[model samples]
Target: MFVIGIDGGGTKTIAILVSSTGEIVAQATGGTSNPNSIGIDEAKNELLKLVHSLSIQNPKAYKNVVSVFAGLSGIESPKYKEEMKQILQNQLPEIAVTIDNDAVIALFSGTFGEPGVVQISGTGSVTYGLDSKGNRHRVGGWGYLIGDEGSGYAIGRAGLHAAFLEKDNRGPSTEISTLLLEYFQVKQIDSMIPLIYGERARTTIASLSKIVMLAADHRDQVALEIIKYQSQQLGEQITALIQISTFQLEGKIPVVLTGGVMNRSDLLLNDIVKTLKDHGINQVEVTVPKLPPVAGAVIAAFQAVNKNLDKISFQNRFLEDYV
Candidate 1:
């Protein structure tokens, strides 16, 4: 029988149709379905609707599907997962549905449920680890107010603050200053505060992260510095995950770079890799997850698939949707 996987995050919800043999037959994309952001009711409705739509598209094949695996961003607590599973089971009574936090699947996706580190950077940020012995630990992911450092919001806020600092002659001139002004089409830093705080101007501020990345790519010193800081922070997260891990490893554990910040910015990713090596953790084997996290969800759904974890490495060669 075939299987399905769903990855629900703050930015987007992704679903993948996987053959029992693990090849991707089809995929569908939808808007944000984070239960924390969009309430549980809305999130559930959106997820079920998307799944139903995809299932119907190829009913002859999908009707044979037997299980579904879902990894969501906000369902961290057991109570949350239980409530979500009940809602999902009610909607998909015939199919076995399992729910887990998004980070679990991300770790599973890379190490194939083995021991290693998976660092995720999306609307927010967190680092997760699972050792060979089934132990798990996590760091960061406290949210925007206290944590979520090196995230898009953090990057954008840094750029904006730097711009205004230069505008008032409080800090040295930075490329972020010029870039932010140009991005917002504002003349002065003084005008930016009110503009950003305005209702209409609220959503566009996060877009500044792209501009910040571009500034660093062009060798802007301040932007590069910001990226370096983020890289170090990310590296530190991995270090903490490894240090706190209870898994007994024969050697250095592998590390996987997942999420937007690691995948998007070479400055940060490379810096992280270098930091690992510098710390003498030479066993780092960084592999890009073959499937978007939705695919990871599908894999998680097969928790009872009775297969060895290490045998399926999620390498580029793996997407074989078996009929």
Candidate 2:
């Protein structure tokens, strides 16, 4: 039997087909399918498109698929998970489907199935961890309204606020205004108000972190301060996770960072590390994901079917292109 693993998020959906023995056969991609961002209907359509495309490309393995593990965004509530599971299962009947939050897959991929902490900072942010005793803990995944402090959206929002403050002479002048203008492709900062508040505002604002990064690279004091502040927020979340989980503080803890913001901003990464050390998380270790989140979904699928991840020899040449 074959297993299908999917990592669905705000930016895109990735599907991978792997054999029972962990050999990767094929992979496919589709547009964003996060139910919260695109609505349930659109999310279902995107899932269907993704699955159909994969099936079409690998017709020989389509009927052999036995199980599917999808780690998706907008699965914060059980209601969304149940609705999405029913929706996706309806598309491919007779196959068992399991759903979880995107952060879970990132954690699995980050730790390679071991116990560790994973921090995600894309359109939204969250820090989740699993301890050696199989205990799981989550912190700061509170969407844009209340939290998501260190997320790309937060950074972008701060960037916009800084630009406006500079424009009004309420704050020191910074190069972020020019960068924001270029990023939004607007003649003036006022032109962005409509777009930012128009539709999918969270995603639109989140994408503007690039401008903040550019400004910081050019030594924009305001931009650097924003990044530093966001880093501290992320560090606080991680620290909280460690305090809440059954993780050991004496030994080095592998802290994996995922998402666009974590990967793109060096200054933010440095500040986060610094903040962690300052908070008595001295033995904390940080690294990037060794495998993609979809691969992590595949690992979850292996566990779901009573299979051992370490027992699978996925090093065969057929799977050379993937981990």
Candidate 3:
């Protein structure tokens, strides 16, 4: 028998076919299946495309498929989950289907389906945790506008604000101003105004986070301050989730740090760990996932069928065949 696992997000969707023995047999990718980013119909179409591709890539494994677990972004509401479940059920009538937020798979990626917390800080940010009793909790992930305090968008926006402040002589001088000008390939600070307000505003602004990271690498005081503040905010979210969950009582809690921003910058990651310790969370066992989030979905597929594959063996097989 075999199972399928899917990780769907605003940017893209990835699906994999894994044998009961934990060998990855086939994989496929498709465009965004996030119902919030694209409409439900379009998202459904994208998911179907990915499944069809997987079947075509390896028909034998696809035929043996018994269950599917999809961890999708923007599937917060029950309405969206049901809609997604129906879509998968309609396509693979005989297979069991499970739908959940993308963060679930991210957490599972590091914990291997064990109870733990995962903090994601990419274009957007969110913190999710699961307790031993199966109770789940989430913090942040409100998107770029109102929340996402420690996200790439947040860092980028702050960098831009600092650049403008220095330009207007309202704040301390920093190299971010010159870097921002070069990044947009413009002569004056105001030249990038139209671009910033353009259609891809969120992504465009979020992209500036790399520039901030670069400045910090050169030991820019202003840029370092921004990272410190953002790391503190993210740390607060993690601590908040821990306090609200059963993890607070546990002697040691697993905390997985994933996503582009957290993974790319050792500086930021170190600061977050420091902030957690400062907040008295001394028992956190922080880990960076060796397996991708999609692997969590695959593990979920196995658990759905009550097949308990050995963790070390599964990781070895998955890494050899899929990673």
Candidate 4:
């Protein structure tokens, strides 16, 4: 049997085909399919195109696929999820389709569907935890406009704010000022206004978080402070999840960290771990994901079929090689 897994985010969509034996046979990519960002119809179309492309090269594999697990952004509402599921089911009537928010699969990817916490800090930040009772709670992820306190967008915005402050001689001089100026290629600090306010503003700003991390690596005080503060915010959110979760509070609980921002920067990761420890969340066990989010979707597919992943040694080894 074959199963398909999809990880759909604001920026892009990825689909992977896995054999029942756990070998990845094919993968495909498409443009952003976040229902919130692109409309439900567009997102559905993107996914359909992706799946069709994957199947075009290997029709037999596609036909044999029994289940599809998709993790998507902008699926917070059950209405949206059901709508997406219906759209996908219509496209692949022979297959069982499961749809959930990106975080759900991310958590599953990290913990293999076990109860655990996953902290995502990419363009935006959000922390999700699953309790033993199947209850899930999410903290943050309000977007760049409101929350997303400890996200790449937040770090980038903080760096930009500090740069602006320095330009106006209102804040301490830091490497970020020059870094931002260089990154944006603006003759004057104010010149960044038009580009920032232009197209893909959120992504453009969030991309700058890398520069902030670079500055922090160089021991820039302002950059370090920004990372520290953001990490603290994320840690606090994790704490909130722990308090309300049904998971054992006293023993070790798996905490998984994912997303580009957190994955790219050890300084930020260290700061977050430190903050967690300082907050008395010392018993937590930070787990390195054994598989990517797409693989998590595959695991979900297995569960949908009432199959146990632990019984498959090849699947475990396949996931280990990739991670």
Tens-digit lDDT string for candidate 4 (1-323): 88888999878898887776677777788998888888888988999998888798678888888899999998877887888899889988977899988888888877776778899888998989877667778777788999898889999999999999998999999999788789878788899899898768998999999889889889999999998899888888888788763544335888888888767646766777887888778888886565778888888887888766763564576565442
How well is each residue in 85-181 modelled by candidate 2, as lDDT tens digits?
9976987788778998888888877665567889998888999887777777888988898899899999999999999998888988889998888
Tens-digit lDDT string for candidate 3 (166-279): 888899988888899998999988888997997899999998999998999899999999999999999999989988835433558899888888766587878788889988
lDDT per prediction? Answer: 0.72, 0.82, 0.88, 0.83
- The TM-score values for the models, in the order shown, are 0.87, 0.83, 0.93, 0.91
Once fitted onto the true fold, the runs of candidate 4 whose alpha carbons sit more than 4 angstroms away are 245-251, 310-323
Ranking, TM-score, top scorer first: 3, 4, 1, 2
Question: Which residue segments of model 1 deviate by more than 4 Å?
Answer: 198-205, 245-247, 307-323
Among the numbered candidates, top lDDT falls to 3
TM-score of 4: 0.91
Model 3, residue pairs in steric clash: none
lDDT agreement of model 4 with the native: 0.83
| Better lDDT candidate (3, 4) | 3
- RMSD of every candidate to native, in Å, equals 3.3, 3.5, 1.9, 2.6
lDDT of 1 at 131: 71
> Model 2 residue 138 lDDT?
89
